[model samples]
Target: MSGTLGPAPGRIAYAELDVFAAYGSFLVQDDTARPDTSRAFITDLMNNLVATTDGAISVGTARRRILPVTLDVRTEAPEDNLDDWDHVTEAGLRITSGRLVVSTFDYRTAIPRTTVPPGDYTARTYASGFDTISDDRIHGDDAYRVILWPGPTVEPRVLKRYPHLPIPG
Candidate 1:
């Protein structure tokens, strides 16, 4: 085994990324320090997420925007087209406790901590059709994907950025 955490079929996972009005973001953190929601969406407009630390990464979203998110765990880096997504960001995640927790800023809806071998890994988040979203029509207009693979730590990078989306302050 490459120490990858395999997908769980039928397991419902959703994180209300925009839980706090001031912080429009969700969390993908290991068993480390408490998530600093105040730090959410503060930097990296292009990437739309911030790696608070090696153990935590906050993914940005529109205010009160809730969309289905899929988590794909792979043994090695997967091939992806940067142009296919409106925005894409990559960062490193350190899982020291052998568990990864995905959740909202408020911790209201947390997918149970997933078990993985303690090690450094890479996380890439992809978003599509987000600029087309409007209040009258939200669902199905946008999509999100978070992929993880066994790898060494790396600095966050924005593979692509949507031009129309407003940059957070």
Candidate 2:
């Protein structure tokens, strides 16, 4: 089965979260504690593109302002579109609860619960516009796409990396 949620604009203004695993049975309610934004943590997050703790699985962003984001769930892995993206990475995520909620760092704006059978899955995150990302302005071209499919947990890998983007650590 395949499903997609949003290429619509989101409320996230930070460069670290475009989509994340929500730790609860409900879509809008997440009971998981937020991860610390330490130098090591941020470095790991940016390098892998997907970072997970017991509480959450976060996908990093290339832009630090509001941008469109999309989430896709598939029955199998999709081909990586490296030419279309500036950065691409993959990681593992286990969903004990069938509810998959895609949202920003804050829960204010979120995609409704996307149901997938509870299991381990691989999440591939694709990001674009890192080359033109700005600290002082918002560029509408920055976007993120996260695709998840059922699979064994594996070490995170960066398929494509943009050298100019800063890694916290």
Candidate 3:
């Protein structure tokens, strides 16, 4: 679990941590360290955005795009798996029930000193189970984009359990 925030389900959503933690691998020279980086609160606040690719929850077809603040992903799975993330990502809501899990919209990267793009580059994850995400999920205040890459982290364990069912190639 990335933190206590992730396990609840849909209320306070979270992505797998490896993506953001990887940032630590980069070493800013002593002189390069920004004053802001020294503050623990600022670091905590940016952690989620840094971890997310685009910032929105995506699934088979990115099933849940506009999430309702009322529905908390923190405690439960979707009632029936729907596209609700689009609503919340675009419109931050006063949550009452479920939590939303959005890694695509929430994740971000820093501008490397190199010629590459200053911030995180878009790289989608590939999966057979999920449908292609819609443009709505790619835009807005808390939205991001990721090309699907083949991996257990992307595919999820729920769909891979059937031994008879071959994993997507």
Candidate 4:
């Protein structure tokens, strides 16, 4: 990912290509593959990389725009004994403009929609943690996250709000 991160398809492609190329194994094709073994790998490598990367693109005479904002949910804790938590994700909206990029995990993407404009968009993300001994008792954090990425210069922000989780005695 670049210094600035968002949902740009081209940037994502470039990033993924850099990552995949480092491996060089995923690009290799079968020995019996057509006239050239590495043909398939080398031919559509860029397009393949772009296509495989999550997000859409729109190129115009003036400028190009990548349409898609990845909604990701990850554990904030180092090694919490929280299991069976639902890191639910849903399609939020699409953002265009700038060379911004955004990603948390080593490999991750989410449902993307091409509706709405660039601004603070609320996404549906929640997680539940339960007590080790008692199944009935629960202690969890359900968050309401808003992604703020208006433009390139603006600092990307993920404001999260955790609702109260009642524990059953």
Best candidate according to TM-score: 1
Q: Predictions ranked by TM-score, top down?
A: 1, 2, 4, 3
What is the lDDT of every predicted structure here?
0.61, 0.56, 0.22, 0.22
**Top-lDDT structure, candidate number:** 1
Mind giving the per-residue lDDT tens digits that candidate 3 earns over 10-118?
3332233212112211111111222233344223223222111121222222223332111122233222211322211111111111222222223224321211112
Instruction: Point out where model 2 deviates above 4 Å.
Output: 1-39, 107-111, 135-137, 166-169
Candidate 1's displacement at residue 28, Å, is: 0.9
lDDT of 2 by residue, 1-169 (tens): 1123343232211122333322210111123334445666456776655566543566666444445556667776775437767777777777776766656546443545556677787777776766665654344355676777778766777888766753421
The superposed Cα distance between candidate 3 and the true structure at residue 125, in angstroms, equals 11
C-alpha-based local distance difference test score of model 3: 0.22
Per-model TM values vs. the true structure = 0.72, 0.69, 0.17, 0.18
Q: Cα deviation of 2 in candidate 1 (Å)?
A: 28
lDDT of 4 by residue, 53-105 (tens): 12221000000112122223221211222123322222232343322233211
